[model samples]
Target: MMKIDIPTMRAQMAEGDKKRDTGLTEPTTITAIKELSYGPHGIENTFDIYYPVGTTTCLPTIVSIHGGGFFYGDKELYRFYTMYLASQGFTVVNFNYRLAPVHQYPAPLEDTNALMNWLLIHGKEHYVDTEQLFLVGDSAGGQLAEQYATLTSNPHYAGLMDFAIADVQFKAVGLNCGAYFIGQTGAINQDFPFYFGETLPEQTAQQFPVESFITTDFPPAFITTATHDFLKDVAEPLATILRSKGVEAEFHLYENPDGKELHHVFHLDQRNPIGKQCNEETLDFFRKFL
Candidate 1:
């Protein structure tokens, strides 16, 4: 296991307080579906769906997973951003998966995949386009999106899985300040052992490595991060690995003029120029691809 300083982690999180000054508000158009069975875990496996004002058919779909260092956060936290994407002619699905310390590695990953399977099976009923699927996630959620994409693309895994997931393909993926490496140290590590359990083997844990999963068949990706954020190094390394494998991956690094901005603040502060720019860049990227 890699060693990390507790005091340093606290200090880095404290720097994110700068986002509190930005005037960001929650979305009013979101409607929560508190009950959409996604996994065998029963009640906790539900997902929330967000859509535009008017009815539509064949619209693009985006699945958004929230970030909480893998141990915290809920589907409600990302309602605004999901609604914003919905407004742009895309159907948005925001779901809750079991967090770490409570559940573990494959648990959360399975929950996410189950939710996608559910959507693919019943998407048309909700006016969602099953054929046009895209994924967007922030922080740990971004990591999950990447992992899920890789799993779906790999014939060995997806083919053998008994889940309800159809052969539906992903159009594109957008990862913002994601922790590409789950079990590794540096920026991505944050009490990951609590999720995998203390007795789990190293080789077993390595299966979740985000960088190693990238493949030539993987969908196009748009990765972004800030200079002051600890995760700045995470996106570039993964992008490099993807490119080496002949995958189409694009990367962007945004630096905050104020030194106080930390990782995972883009969705929290909508008024900040940096936050708006991040949203714009992400939306533009998806629009072009989807």
Candidate 2:
């Protein structure tokens, strides 16, 4: 079993923050920006939008969700990535949903769905091509993205779907080191009680498992996992599930070229050769689909 050195990880995270502030490891630029709030859940339920300059015509949009174990991350932490995608000519929306231990299952998912509905309703006004919607998430965000896709497709969530402003179709989804399953086999399954307030019932837990929820109608997906990641098993099975359902799917496992690194190290060390290569491959994959 691979173990994460918490102290070393914290140091690396601090280093990344320093690099971000110094602009030495910034991603890219965005032309215009806006704040979006459509719910009554107070200021924390808001999102930021980034678009290219002079984009009057409808343009593709990518909604990015950040990850911090469902308890720590915020939209701002992912600004670099969103801005980079926006610079590539895709409108990018990054938002904060309610966190766990305060807001449990269905809350975060509902918040994301609300954001999606808001986007569809306001897409035309924002000059967005609602039909070309793409969902991208890293880690916890990826899990929510998959859940959102599943929820939107289910008739039980029809009321949620009815509020969508436009006839948006999810074209593709990108899962970066996502936690796709959340039961006994999950990496952080033990953390569920901490997040959910209590141990989840079997059925309740099943609802959050992307592998169990996926259907043939689920959109195409591109998923990535690091070889040394604790979550590697979490995402790989979902790729097989997607293919079995005839949904286009691609999965890549990245390993450290020097063979010395740990899970979730990619985002923290962007200058690392393997990390850079993974980002490049991700961009190339997006270009092919978008």
Candidate 3:
């Protein structure tokens, strides 16, 4: 496993994010609300909402989660992408959660649940159709999305976590190059402690064994990975497990046969044709659930 320097990696990503154009046009009909607090976990537990301008009618909601090896990233960094999704005629909720090495294990998960509860209570006010909700997460965030999906749909899994299964239900989920498998050897394995905290290795394994939580009730999924993405190995197996469980799922592998392959979360770069194509496909998949 590769050694990670979180600060350096974050700085690199921040620089890259600054240069990428969101490729979203004038919304002409969109409203963006920012920094809505969902809980007291910290300022990071806030979210942003975007939707059609002046629309009172309920609309499908797309809740997006950003990935940063469980140590970085926040809602602000994802604004452009989130707003672009909103301009496409859906209500989008992009949020920030407590980071690891500071907050640890279930903190992010709990923050997610609280956000859902907030949406359930306040979604109508923002014209969000609670009935038509979807989730989108990339990289480490993808792992959280998968975990949250299971906790919402699988009672047995929820019980193991010592919490009541959430009443929320997701219409579908878009997991982009997510790292679903947790255990590994090497420098990468060392990073687990930051998020899993001081929990026993066995307990940590049980808590995040995404594959074990799969069931027929799992929500439909739009899963994607790039030919060169580090997480490609797990992404395919996840989609396969979902399909095997009789859940509706689609797996897409973005490729570059003529040149170097796309990297992790390449979809964030709208300048890339392949990335743009993947985003369109993902949106189409989300629309099916609506």
CA-lDDT, candidates in order? 0.71, 0.70, 0.83
- lDDT tens string, model 2, 167-260? 4568888888887766536533465554554555554554544466567888888888897787888788888888998888889888876778
In model 2, the clashing pairs are: 120-166, 121-165
Q: What is the lDDT for 98 in model 3?
A: 95
TM-score of each model, in listed order: 0.82, 0.82, 0.91
Best-to-worst order by TM-score is 3, 1, 2
Worst 10 residues of 1 by lDDT: 182-191
- Give one clash count per candidate, in the order shown: 0, 2, 0
> Could you give candidate 1's per-residue lDDT for residues 57-104 as a string of tens digits?
657888888876666666756666677777666788888889766687
Per-residue C-alpha lDDT of model 3 across residues 167-230, encoded as one tens digit per residue: 7899999999998867533322455666665445565566655677778999999999998898
Q: List the residue pairs that clash in candidate 3.
A: none
**What value does the lDDT take at residue 144 in candidate 3?**
90
**lDDT: worst 10-residue window of model 2:** 158-167
Range of the 10 consecutive residues with the lowest summed lDDT in candidate 3: 183-192
- lDDT, residue 161, candidate 3: 74
**Error in Å for residue 160 of model 3:** 1.6
